[model samples]
Target: MTDLLPLWRDLLLGGFILLAYTTEAMTGFGSIVIALSLGALILPIDDVQTVLVPLNICMTGFLSWRHRNHIDWRLLGRLIMPFMLAGTVLGYWVQPVLGGALLKVGFALLVLWFVLRELRRAARGHVAAPKSGWWSRGIVLGAGVTHGLFASGGPLLVYGLAGLSLDKARFRATLILVWFSLNSLLTLLYLNQGRLQPLAPHVLAYLPLIPLGIVLGERLHHRVDEVTFRLWIYRVLAVSASALLLASLLQLG
Candidate 1:
C-alpha cells in the first residue's frame, strides 16, 4: 500500500467528494453517482472503489439515521436482507474479476437501462408504482442484486417507488435507509474480502463536505415541490449516468 499526495490531488477533488454527499442529503441519492464519476476521472477504477466505498459508509450512515423511521422493516424483510445478502457476497467476488473499468461500465449500463425503461413507461402512462406485497418479491430480490452490484440500484428503486402511491418524503426517506444500510453492509463484506481499503486521510479530506451538502440539500428539498423534485432527480440520473458511462467507455477505448 502506498500514499501519494500528487499535486493534482487537491481541493477540487475534495470538492467533488462533497458534491456526492450534498446531492445525497438533498435528494436521498447522488453520492455514489458523484463519487464514481468524479473518482473515475482522476483515480484509477480500483482506487475509486477502495476509496469511495468507505466514504459511502459515512454518507449513507448519516442519511440512514435521518430516514431511520421511514424504512418499513416489515416490507424491508420482504426485500432487503435475503436479497442483498446474496448480492453482497457477489459484489465482493465480482470486484476482482471485473476490475475498475468494467464495474464502472456495468453500473452505467444498469443505470441507463433502468432509467430509460422508467422513462418509456412514464411516457406510455404505464408507470403504476410499487405496491407492497409478497407478490413483489421477485422485483425486490432483483433490485437487491442490482443494489449489491453497483449501489446504483436507485434507478430501479427510485422509479419503482415513483410508481407507488407513496408520499414524497416517505419515498425518498425509505430509499435513504435502504441504500445507506446496504452500502454499509457491502463495504464491510468487501473489507472482509480484502478488496476495500481503508482511506482515513482520503475520507477525512471530504468529511466536512457530507454534512455541508446534506444541510444544503435539505434546504433545497424543502424549497422545491415534490413533482418538480422527482422530475429533476430523474433528469440528473439520466444525464449524470450517461456522462459517466460515456467517459468510462472512452477511457476504456
Candidate 2:
C-alpha cells in the first residue's frame, strides 16, 4: 500500500473530492480532471488518479443509473463509444513512447480552439448546428486518447457532443453513461495491475462524498435553464483547457 497521507492532506483531498464530484454530478463529466488537478497539489498525480478513477466509478455509476432513462443510447453505442475506445487503446499503447507534456499541450490547445469558437458564436446568438461526418468522429477519437493518457478527455468529448445540440437532461445523462463505461474500464485496468490495492483506503474514505455531491448537484441541475447550462459548459471547458495548458507549460519549464 502507498504510505498514508498526513491527516490534513487527507482532509484537503476529501474537500477536493466533494467539490469535484459535485461538479460531475451536475455537469455529467469533470470529476476526474477537477479532482486530479486539485489533488495533485498534495499527492503525486499518479496516486491522485489511482484514487480518483475508482471513486469516479461510484459517482458515474450512480448518476448513470439515476438518469438511465434519459440516455441517448443510439448516439453512445453508434458513434462515441467505438471511436473513443479505439483511440483510448491506441493512446495507452503509445503512452510510453510519447512525452506527457507534448500530449497535454496539444490536447489543451485543441480544446481551447473549439471552445473559443463556440463561445464566440454563442455570444453572437448563433447556434452552430450539430456537427457530423469524420470531423466530429476525429474529435471523439482524440478525446479517448487523452482519456487514456491523462484521464482528462472530458473537454474534447464535450466539444464533440455539443454539436448534437442535446437538451440539458439528455446531454448530461448520456455523457455520464459514457463516463461510467470509460471509468469502469480504467478501474478494471487498475485492478488487474494491482494499483487499486494500495489506494483502497482512500477510495473508501472518499466514497461517501459521491452521494452528497449528487444530492447537492442534482438540486442545482434542476434550476439551470438549457441555454445557461450550455453556456456554463463552454465556460467550464475554457477553464479546464486553460488549466491543462498552464500546467503542461509549467511542467516543461
Number of the predicted model whose lDDT against the real structure is largest? 2
For candidate 2, list the clashing residue pairs, or say none. 130-163
Predicted structure 2, TM vs. truth: 0.92
lDDT of 2 by residue, 112-166 (tens): 8988898899999997776677888998998898888777778888877765758
Q: Candidate 1: TM-score?
A: 0.81
Model 1 Cα lDDT, one tens digit per residue, 1-253: 1355664565656777677676777777767766667766767655565566677677778767777777666645656466655655565566456545666677678777877876677677674656556545545555555565556566655644455655657666767777767777777766776765555567667667767777887888788897677666777688658867876887888
Q: Which ranges of candidate 1 are over 4 A from the true structure? A: 1-7, 99-103, 120-139, 160-162, 193-198
Candidates in order, TM-scores: namely 0.81, 0.92
